[model samples]
Target chain A: MDWQKLISFITVLVTLFLIVRSEIKKYKLRKTRPCGSDCNCAVLKEVSLKKLK
Target chain B: MNYFAIIGNPNCGKTTIFNELTGLRQKVGNYPGVTVEKKEGKILFKDGTEITLLDLPGTYSLTANSPDEKIVSDILLRKRIDIQRPEGIVCVVDASNLERNLYLVSQIIDQRFPLIIVLNMVDVAEDTGLIIDVGKLSKLLGVSVIKTVGIKRKGIDELKRAIQGKFQVSTAVRQWKLPEIVREEHEELTQLLIKHNSVKEDVAVYDAAALLSSPKQLKEFKDELKPEILDHVLLDHQRLESLGYDRHSIFVKSRIEWVRSICSEVVSIGEKKKSYTDIIDSIATHKFWGYIIFLTLMILMFQSIFTWATIPMNFISKGFDWIGYQLGALIPHGDLHDLIILGAVRGVGAVVTFLPQILLLFLFLGVLEDTGYMARAAFIMDRLMNKVGLHGKAFIPMLSSFACAIPGIMATRTIENPRDRLVTMMVAPLMSCSARLPVYSLLIAAFIPNLLVFGFWNLQGIVMISLYMLGLVMALLMAFIFKKTILKGKTPDFIMELPPYRLPSLKNILIQMWERSVLFLKKAGTIILGVSIILWFLATYPKIENGNPSEKLAHSFIGQAGQFIEPLMKPLGFDWKIDISILSSLLQREVFVSSISTIYNIQNADDKTVSLKSQMQKDLDTSTGLPRFTILTAICIMVYYVLAMQCMSTLTVVKRETNSWKWPFFQFAYMTGLAYLVTFIVYRVGLSFI
Candidate 1:
């Protein structure tokens, strides 16, 4: 392969990796935090439960 | 590090003081079980003594009627194992509203923590012809008092010095005497709690009084406490009721009387004059003029958003176009160049060009909030909201949803009733969040005429405002339906305190604008950029070596997927290309613009200098031999975006807030179903008019 093709290939790979990593991180964070990272919506379930009580 | 909590009533300038003390060193999170925000920051002193200052959610008292009050009470009583109890407390109060502010301070004093009273907004008090003898007030309250104007950074040094100084717990503040019979019962209950519940000596009296009045807390302690303590509390409550004394009123009345005595002694009024706030509020909150002013402001804001943003948006658009032209020249015509020029630049630029609109929206919201007009807006909206069976408190969250739905949903915690809160959450996403602005702005600017309407209002601005009003009207309609049918409830009485109008702090407004702008830019660089590259690859690969660009795109992976969905979208006047954009935008609404830009870039690769708008205008339907996107189609698209539940983050937050998947899924199904039905109707009806 030519040098330009090699560079493009690596860039695509890096892009794919970052996208996949971000999705995984977001999924795990959602499971644990539920509101995504930046929002202040985490721990709402406990509050909702208290409201129910 | 020593921990000190800052607690105050709402609108007491507590947050401003907290920001002044801990500039950029702050973290925001949610306290468990309530939507109250947990804001913590580190205050570093000159001598290297580090103190962690927690900005507790603003509450009137430790009465625990709402979650905010409960959280404050819990923290002060050291009941929350998740957070360490503060070693001391800094109780902030509005000096201008001293008589009412002192009520909460009296309750905090009962908690018996080493406390300091920071008299905030003292300048506002002085302006109203009120003079407070700070020294005499401090001696009477038995705590150190530091006068401050939090917004101006006045008295910050002395406030910090007090925080770092040796703390003193004053016993003299609780001189208010309860009736003898009630005092005997309270003492007995306090002893029982101390012995049986292991309650601390300093807070047992406060807890005993709280338990007697609040049945919610009594029920909470039922499971953990020994039955003897429960029986004792019940018996004490009965004994107090047997007499002519109301258990709750005794504590409240006695405290108020004492606070009133203290205020009368330390505060003196000079020659009175009406302030600017009162002068303005006469019209701002008047029944008839208020609505007119609000409508005029809405019109002005929408008009300015379009007119003021044009220059900067054009500059950004031209800059991106020039860069794309340069990149096309610098590299060979191949996949690498296509990825850079068509995919990344076009996609990011399409979204980035809308930054001015986003910033303007945030700036207006900031000014409204800082000038205390937002609260008045809520007060004004209360009657209409009540007509729809929603509390006035719900209007603030709805207003906030105009910026974004996540924080708006989180802000629903202030509504104490579960049904009302749930109903608010179910409809908040219908408000057009900032994410939808790009889609609306792009379509409006391209399709709607920019001529003056009646020689005053811009036609484009009117269309934009119509779309926003459509979202709001639909939201209120949904809220009414939810309240009447599924989550039926009565609208509770609405009471809100309107803070006096003050000049907005430019520094604070700019900081908010900068923070929100950076968030927008970050999303553009990351999620939008990623989706752009992926879409570009899907459109470019499996290349037909001998075919034209359109032919190659038609046979690509993305093209096939879009074709699969094209039949479903045809009723709305959308083709395969628009179908792909709709599908990609499910992750976030702004991605719709980026997806469209990327698709157009790939199709018109030979002409890199044409703007996206011009390219879109030039697109022709092969079958009809007419322009692809007509005014009808643009209106349909805008209507669809206004109602669609297209954001994943909002869905996740709804799930978290409800603690069940049932509500979020229900919300999604209804919103999307509504969007599809409305767009179809709009398309069919619009076509008839043509």
Candidate 2:
């Protein structure tokens, strides 16, 4: 493969990794943490859980 | 530096005061374990001391009825481990509603924190012919009261002075006493708390009163208390109720009485004249006229977003072309150049061009919200929302959804009922957000006839409005169905305070617009940048040897995927190229226009100047050999977007909001299914008629 192709490939991989990283982090965090407020409404619960941690 | 918290009722101008005091020094984050905003800002005292102000969520009382109220309760009780107990308190009360506003003040007095009462909206109170004696009120409550009009910056200096002054430890702030039975229970709980070292000596009384008064508020100290202790508290609460005085009424009735007594001494009316807001609300809230006014306002908003944004959008489109040309000259024409020009610049251009409409949408929304008409709109829509098993409070969130669903979903925190909030969250994405504008406009310009009705009304404008209204009607209908089916529950009775109308502050509107634009750009920089490059790689790889570039693209990875999905989209009148755009755009709706631009190999790819539109119009179907896009096809595409949850960011937020994969995936499935079914019928029936 040419140098251009190599750089482009690496960038795409990095981008994909970053995107997937956020989703996975959220998933792991959601499982471990309970929401701070006792309200049963889950609106923004992931962020709420993250804040609690 | 010390920490102080600003708490007040909703629509009591608490935010206005926060903004005036802090100006641009504010930082916003979610409160611990909740989506409620934790706004912190720094204020420098004249004596060179600094104070950090935390703007807590507006609450009616210390009672933890909602998540927002719980946050306030937790913070004031010093239960949250992440935050320190604030050194002082600024209780913002509306002078116009002094009696009700003082109810919160009385509760705060029970805590006996260093307190200052900020009587906000004193001008409004005066206009209503209600004169408030701030000094007398302060004397009676045994606290410092500063009268300020937050929006006008009136008495702000005095408020600052009061905050800097040494707070007094008053012995007489708690005027209302509990009944003999409840007082005995409170003392027993206080003794238990002190014995167990559950609270400090001073906090024992407040904690005991809170725990005995409302058992649910004990959740604030769930980590520290044993199960048996909690059960004991509940048992005591039941005993108090069994002894004939209800816990809620015992607290509420005494508090109301205290507030009334204070107001009677310090408040008087000069005259009771009908204010301008009263005159306006008569028509704006009228059953028939209200609906008409609302429809007219929505139509005007949609029309402006469609027609007024065109000039700047064209300019933004051309700006991208100029950048592309400059890059062509500066960089050697190769894979790097192609990727930068086609993938990055064009992708950014597509998203940036939607800025004008987004700003306009926020501009109108800010005006509605700032003028207090947004609450009125909700009040009017509550009757209809009731029919759909949704509360009227859901209307503000749904209205916000028209701008974008992220904030709209976040706004669902205002809806107290869990089920209703979830249902609102589910249907919010069905509102045609600004991201969908580029897709609709592109398809409409390419396919829909530009004929004007009666040589006056533009057909394209009407089509745009129809698409928006279609989303609204569908969202309401689906919300109704969802409420009846999967998320069925009792819709809470909506109680909203309608603040008097004021002219929307131009500075606030501009600041809101600026913030939204920055958020949009931030997304473009991060998620869109990543998605754009990845999609470009997918569309460019697996090159064909010694063939036409278009033919080479056909064999690319994304091209192959599109072809794989072609059969499924055939009923909706979408070709493989359109199908590919649909797949890529699931990450973001605006990506559809850019992905199509990249696939078609249009250099500038501006939707204006007829380049992209003409390309789309002349494109032929491989099988039918007819123009790829028709009026029917455009309608079908728009319908699909109107129904589909084609935004990953929205879904991520949904997962966060619902705290489960069950709801977001269910949202994806139901919205996608409905989109496909509706598009299929629209396309098939239209083909037969045409």
Candidate 3:
């Protein structure tokens, strides 16, 4: 076939693959890393105040 | 309605006010084709008026040293800038941190921008028992004042009314202009100010002092000033420098005083209560426990991405193979049938297959950043960052690369030191971003078994983690090496402002995620679409349909092409089939899968029963009459994709970020060379066994 059509077809196929791949990955994810980890990765800054004399 | 450019120090609630004004509708995208994200949105007035609000990067002053700070100066100047010149600017000041934030606002006043004083974070002010008279402060600064809690979306309508009335009403009362006393102090040394340029004759003294403080700027003004009066201006500036009012101090003191008075008047402090942010930060920044918690969070992100992303990937594989069959059935057994099944559909499917992981990675990163945890992550890494000759602030960009290198590279602009900035930019791309995950996943899935490594962990997962760690360690090593050798310079001293910890607004977080996802689809999608089409063509075309068709096309142009390269790659455990796959992989590394699938499918016309994976395991090489899963071939493929310059999108990013082809060209060359050498070693070593 012509180069243009081949390119067009590949574009469509890649899109389909990406969509399907994402969905499948999502489906598998439910089986792993169930979100409630006790790891407190949230960051914050601390300021120490001096006591009044 | 008048436009208001909400300007403040980087972490001083400027973005929060912008978010509050726009309400989850702002568009975040690359500035034109550049990587710098330009934020623009509008705020509607109470009287149905609309004022466009620009949220420029936070800067200490308009002296404009870095590109980010330059943006603040450029917008305020409205000269040679691409965006609209704001009619007025609502300077957002954290009442608690008035000195630094007001440093920018006072500079804005000199630019002669219409002014609205937005005393943000008044809640914090109130908690501290700080009382400020808003009306009196407004009179002192010659502008209107509005108190706002950007996170809670409070005092918004009042802000809107102020913006709407800015053009019609004159807020100019007490001028923040430099006192004649300060100017006279300089004049005692010489009449340099009047002699230098006709421009400064009517200009504010604050502007003149700011220019003199900058060494390069002082020289530039001296050189540019009319030669006839240069001596007087130089003499005057020297005299002014002696007066305890050097330009920077005078400038700083002026804004500090203005902000201090304004904050004291209207804000009232009540009982001191613990902030939600502080409570959470204590754990996140625990001296010892913080690191452990951070490690666990990281492991979760990686593990979840792989296990979660693989399911849809399988469905995608099956669906594409099925479509190939259906198209093969319809095309009357001609070249078109082959083209549809093998060339177009398969080519696109290979690249498209990885979208799920990319989207999920972006979504997770978006939440991390919006929640303020990401900044805290930088804070935690700062002590470590200093050892590597980078500021704690530089770690923010490095961490940002885990989601993608493009944004991470753009973020390096925050590094003030020119040497450190360039070093960060060069090594950032080495980080194994989410885009590289598919290559790692496919290789490990295909070659590495589910065997336990070191008794407990999965060997495949361990290998995957190793590759990522290797990249990071290399980046650090390279930065150290560059600092000592190529970029020999003293590392700049570190001074980073730690923003207050706040529970990130969920409304704002979701909006950021949506904007990023849409931008990825719009910008990266277009380029990927183009590349996908081109790759598909290289796999198809020049078909042979005549008698002895297999024999006729066996030695066709592509075969001959592959044949020429076959001997060269044989040491790496690659035959022509592997060579062709590598060639077709130019668009992206993952295309390696579909490329092999298409080639093998054409050879086995009994393609009805076997899946793509099955076909690969079953296909026999004529030379050996055995399956093609040679130990050498697997190693070669893995190493090649691991370091190769396979993604045009990456090169596109490099070009845009550096604003030149020189950097991207060097990037492609170095990475490809590194990939070739690494793959060669792996393939040759594997071949020794087979």
Candidate 4:
């Protein structure tokens, strides 16, 4: 492949990797703390988890 | 590092003081419930000592009525296993409303934490012709008192010095004496808790009193206490109530009486004069004029979003076009060049042009919030909210949803009733968050004309506000349905404090605008860019070497998927490309604009100068040989976006807030079903008129 094509291929690969990683992180965060990324009400999270269980 | 927590009643400027001390802009609005969760920042002292400062949500008392308020008592009582109790507490109170503000301080004194009282907003107090004897008040409270104007950074150094000094637990005696029988019951319960639950002696008293006052707290200790002990506590609660002593209000009443007595001793009235806040409030909160003024402000804000943002948007649009041209020339004619210009530049540029609109919206919201007008807006909205069977407190969360639904969902923690909170969460996403701004702006700017209405209002601006009002009306309608059918309950009384108005801090407003703008840019660079690249790939291959661009795209992977979905969307006047955009935007609403841009950029690869709006304007359906996006189509799409549950993040937050997958799934089904039904009706009705 040409140099430019090689760079484009690598860029696309990296973008895919980053998107997947972000999705996984968001999923795990949702499991533990459902208040989204903006809040840190861990007490509520615990109570919620206990209630869920 | 030593830890300190700043706690106070809502709107008393705990966040303002926290921001001033830590130099972090943690969103200090003049309305209550601005900080719905705990935010922590480190303050570096002069001697290289760093103290971790936590800004907790505001609460009225330690009795802990709502989930947000419960977080305060949980931390202070050391009930949560995750967070350690702070070494000292900074009890921030509004100097202008000391008598009411000190009720929480009295509760804190009973906890016996090393404390400092920040008499914030002293200027507001003085403007009302009240002088406070800080020294005498300090002696009476038996804690160090520091007077401060948090917004101006006045007395910050003194406050910091006091925080860094050796801390002492307040030696102030509990001034409010419990009645003889209530004291007996409280002491008895305290000993029982210490003996049975292994609770610490210091906190056991507070816990027992809380449990006796609010039997709901017994659920927290259910695992620790035996059934007999729980039954004993329940019996004491019943005995107090039977004796005609309101178990709930006795402590609150006594504390208020003590705070009033202290205020009488330490506060002196200088002159009886009407403040500016009063004069403005006469009309600002007047039942008739308030609605008129609010509607006028809404019109002006929506008008400015269009009028003020045009120049900057055009510049940004042209800048991206220039960059795309330059890059297209620099790279050889190949797939790499196509990817760079089509995938990255055009796609991201399509969304970035809306930055000016987003910034203007945040700026207006910041000014309204900073000047305390937002609270009045809530007050004005209360009667209507109650009529729809929602708590007046739900108004703040709904207003917050205009920025984004995530924080809006989180802000529902301040609603004490679960059913009311759930109903609010279900409808908050229908408020047309900033993510949908691109879709609305794109469609309206392309199809809606900018004629003068009644010799003043722009037709485009009116359409824009109408779209917003449509979302709001649908949200209220849904809330009403939910209240009357599934989530039926009596609307509780709405009691909100109307804060005195002050001049908005320009620096704070600018910081808010800057922060929101950066967040938008980040999303453009990350999610939008990623989706654009992927869409470009899907449309590019498998390649047809001898085919025209349209012929090539028609058989591409994205084309196949779009064509598959096109049949389902045909009734709504959407073609395959619009179907693809709709499906992609489920990840996030703004992705719809970028998806359309990417798709169009590939279709018109030969034409480099046409903007997305113009391309959309020229697009035609092959079967009918007519323009694909008529004004009716634009209106239908805009209506669909206003009601659609298209954001994954909002769904995830709903799942978390409601603590069930059932609610989020139900929300998705209902909102999407509503969107489809409404858009179908509008489209069919418009067709009949034509």
Candidate 5:
């Protein structure tokens, strides 16, 4: 394939991968952990300590 | 290797000290089975002995009321397998508030670990006319105490040396005498724990006290400890409560007394210093002036985002245009050239041109936070939040949502009420994030007049503010409705400390700005790049055998699809092209801008460098024989975007945050339905007038 076609194919594949990877990971995590309604890990603040000093 | 922990009360500059000691050498991971982050760093001594420093979550005490506090308690109690128990503890304290801050120190010292107390923010204490005798305090607590201003990096060398030196276990365990009954109960628990092998024989007295004091602590060790051991602890707890000796209060009272005794011995006050921070707080948290100031600041921030980013956006747009023009000339006029020019470059450029505005928004946020004003903003918004049925703390996450909903939704962790947190997460995306800026800017620039509202105010900036406020108004309205009906719960009180005001460090603000902007640019390069190519292919395929290149777009798959949906978009003044762009926007909101650019580039292959704005302005409606982008149409589109759930990534994040398909789907349905209704109203209303 030409560079244009080659680049377009790779780009499409990468975008699909980026979108799919997170969904699958989140799916597995939710299924396995099932931390009730209150345990949304995404909202957890990633701080070196509590509150930004 | 020696393991050490840095523990402190909130806002005592513990994080600053950790950053100084670690300096970009720390790893952030989640504590096992909990979402709270676990931070660990390596500190190398001159003698080549390495110390692993764990920055425990800052809590007032080790009582474990919150998940973060539980993580700290577990590590200190040697109950976590993910982290090793520290051999020594660096108990950071705020010297300015020694009486209150030392409460946690009393608890830490009870652990009987080799401890060093770094009295942080000594400069603030000295400014407040409080003189603390470091040697005397150290002697009283029976631990080494070093005074340091964490921000100024003063006394750091001494602190490092003290950490490496021969460590001494604190005598506070012996000094602060517990009640005879409680002491007897603590010993019985320790013996029981050791007998059950739930705890080592060398367990600290405080850890034993924690077992009897906190019911949560027993639950944490439920699998390890025998049922009878837990029953016995609960039995002791009941016995203490029945005898009018509340274990929790008794422990708290003893710690407070210990802290007060140490303060009286080592600290002297020359005068009660009056604070400028107090004066500022009075105004910033005032009932009336605070709201006015907040609104004015928000208006100014939005105005600057629109005005300041224009020049850089223009430069980026032009640079991309010039490159596309060059590529068009160098490459042969074929499918390959068209794909490169229309598919990738224009798509990325459409999103990236808005980076300057994104960076400026984050810069202002960093400043507000660093100056200790963000907490006050939350305080001011608390009463208003209560009116809308959300806890006052919901304002912080909603404010964060103005930047991005992912982190904003993530910030809901601070909210204690599950229903309040869910409501906040569901409505967070209604806050107009930086991603929506490009669409609003483009539509406003194309259709809205650039004239001033008065003699001085820019009309365009006012429109930008209106668009943002539209989102805010809708968010509050939806939060109110949801809280009252679906996710009903009592509003929790917002309790937070207001840190002393200090000059914001320019380095930290710039670093924050860079990180946020880089994340936006990365999306442009990766996700937008891919989507654009897919869109280009759809818009260029199934070409007619003998058609003009410009007309070939109408014959392509995308054009047919757009036409198929054209009737649905007709009432909102959107044509086939706009319909296609809207469809593409489902992946990402900013993709709408790029999709339009790609479509126009494909149609206007003859005119290479004409800007997308002029093309949008010149686009004509076939039936009305008038320009397609009218003031009414632009307003309708902006209104639509303000309410639409266009970005798929946000939905995924919502799913992850809510941990169910139910909430994300409801969010998507309600938002899309609201967008259509509002857009129809705005469009119909505008058409009636003009």
Candidate 6:
């Protein structure tokens, strides 16, 4: 492969690594939730931005 | 202990009330036969009483169309009740839109159940300077009315108390007001109810308009109704229409008038909260820029699916393949080793191939939906879609199809018009769904030289972009043709509310992503596993010893099946191996590439390390003296798969949503036929150029 092609491949590889890292972090976060009584703790609401305003 | 159900149109806040009353005590499970969920919980009142709250699907009216709407009618007549019927019903009405909301309320009243009204979003209406006299309105309707702002948990305790206040085993049955003449006729006829003082176990409106709106319900009512009751009902409906009030329409106009009158009495204008959605929507739904944004979003979606998930894909493929090899070494030599290495482990590895892209697809979709941007996306796309003699609702299905066609087609349930939905489903597969990306990425990398065009656009990116556009053009063209011919009908009038933008609920996004991944895995476990084993069996059985005993899979059942189809596809430059892979892809399109690898005995080849492009470059037909993959052949295959509806998951969704195998089966047949014809044309035309 030419230098440009090699560089392109490496750049893509880096991007791929970043994508996987982000995905695994998301998975780990989700897994810790563990389908318990606490699942409903999502607390569907705005973050009280009124106070900040 | 009696049960009650809360039902209304979407955004009615049935969920808010359920959360307020039940807290975390609800059980969320699927309705039987379909994946649509049912949420139910119980509340104990201070008066030594308890009530079960069934939060049915948020629906506009009781007419059964989609499985979601079917929940309303099903729960009312207690149809398909493995569980007990509720003694009472609470119909939710958005207070601001009371006039429109009460259309459903009146319909429920006709069912002759112990009904109550939970007027939600009262605060929003009040903030908009609208007032409502709840007591006066309650007296007019002769039903208990409870005011609630479910988001703030205000008046929830009162609503729960009211629910418990009226959970009687029975209520006095009152005939629906069908104007003067119908009231007189009802007096003359025999009592339709089980008792005068109790709610009718069942009630039917002799209104002609109701009959016109619902064929399924009318058909059933005709079989069961008393001759006189049925006769008078039809007459009353006609008489009302003569006065210019269609049974269904009049019921709405009057209720809306009543609600408006009550609001005039008690409500006053506050500072008008300007609808921010309008300002944002104006730009997003613009004719030109809206289309631009839609295309940009689609391109970004494709980029995420193909470019973002490469690492996880490589890891999974390499890891799984390594595991397969290790197991092969550990297992004793025999059919057992073949089954373990090539069938079970290899099959799993094959399915995992596309998991990264699927995950990314679900993640972005979840984010878009949870963040409330998808609603705006539909709104934006709707403007352009309407010009083509299609409804605005077509945008939702095509938008959702970007994640995967199956869910997208199923999502078409929200589109009220049947003809519109059918056309949407038929064309939805043409969207660059997550499923097609794997096949596209693999093929493009192998065929299209990786070089920049215009010193900017990568050749691979350009090809990917072209494939997406091709698919979209094909879908729209197909929809246009279908609308004009096969499923020809008037394009339904568009009416949809564009909800305000909200920060995406991260929790909801994560949960949705999890659910989709689990479902995909389950399907992969069954269909992909089965295909892999059958494939391994095809490529392995009846081995030729010099080439290895496992070389001649042609005598196997699957191999024979591929051979049978090979002659038809040979003109397209596809050999028997390609034929078999294409057949396997009836379950899923990605399986085609993996099957090709297996059939060619390149399953053990490290294509990732050597690059699939180089490997394909080296492969040749032993007798033909030409490479197996010519430029024309590559283009033909790409064009063919782009238009094909090869995913069984998509068909299953069509079947469930349509509640009939007819539409789904038709979709499969037409798509495959289109694929074949297009591939043939491409191959023939491109070969002439060469």
Among these predictions, the greatest lDDT belongs to 4
The Cα error of candidate 6 at residue B535, in Å, is 1.7
> How do the residues B119-205 of candidate 3 rate in per-residue lDDT, one tens digit apiece?
888776766556666777677667777888877889987887667675322343224445676645444323444454434332424
Candidate 6 lDDT tens digits, B1-690: 477777776666676577678763231111111112355677777776777777766666666655456655666755554556777788888887776676677666656668888888787687565777788777667778889877567888888777766532223233234456534544433244233222333433322334433445457668655676567556755765686655455444544565455456655566777766567667777778777876776567655566677788888878876887687678655555665555556556655677877787777776666445676676665655766656676777686677678556655655556677778888898887766766777677677777867775567767787887888778777888888887777776666655445455454456666766775676566555555655665566444565422235555566677778888999777877677877778767877766665554433323324434455666676577788886666777788888888886577556545556787789888888888888898888888899
In terms of lDDT, the poorest run of 10 residues in model 1 chain B is: B25-34
Ranking by lDDT: 4, 1, 5, 2, 6, 3
Question: TM-score of predicted model 2?
Answer: 0.88
- i-RMS of candidate 6: 19.3
Span of 10 residues, lowest total lDDT, candidate 6 chain B: B27-36
Q: Write the per-residue lDDT of candidate 2 for residues B470-583, one digit (tens) a residue.
A: 988888999999988887888878777777888887777788788778877876777677777877888888876776666677788988898899998988988888898888
Q: Candidates sorted by TM-score, descending order?
A: 4, 1, 2, 5, 3, 6
Decoy 1 TM-score against native: 0.95
Q: Each model's TM-score?
A: 0.95, 0.88, 0.78, 0.96, 0.87, 0.74
What tens digits encode model 4's per-residue C-alpha lDDT throughout B473-553?
898999999999988888889899999999999989999899889889988999999989888888887778787777788
Best by DockQ: 4
Docking class of 6: incorrect
lDDT of 5 by residue, A1-53 (tens): 67766665565666678756754665455433322112212223211122211
Error of 4 at B271 (Å): 2.0
Q: How accurate is candidate 5 locally (lDDT)?
A: 0.76
What are the per-model DockQ values? 0.36, 0.19, 0.02, 0.38, 0.14, 0.02
Give the per-residue Cα lDDT of candidate 5 at B442.
90
Kindly report which residue stretches of model 2 are placed more than 4 angstroms away from their true locations once superposed. A1-53, B25-35, B46-48, B177-197, B200-247, B272-274, B451-457, B602-610
Question: What TM-score, to 2 decimals, does candidate 4 have?
Answer: 0.96
Candidate ordering by DockQ (highest first): 4, 1, 2, 5, 3, 6
Better of 3 and 6 by lDDT: 6
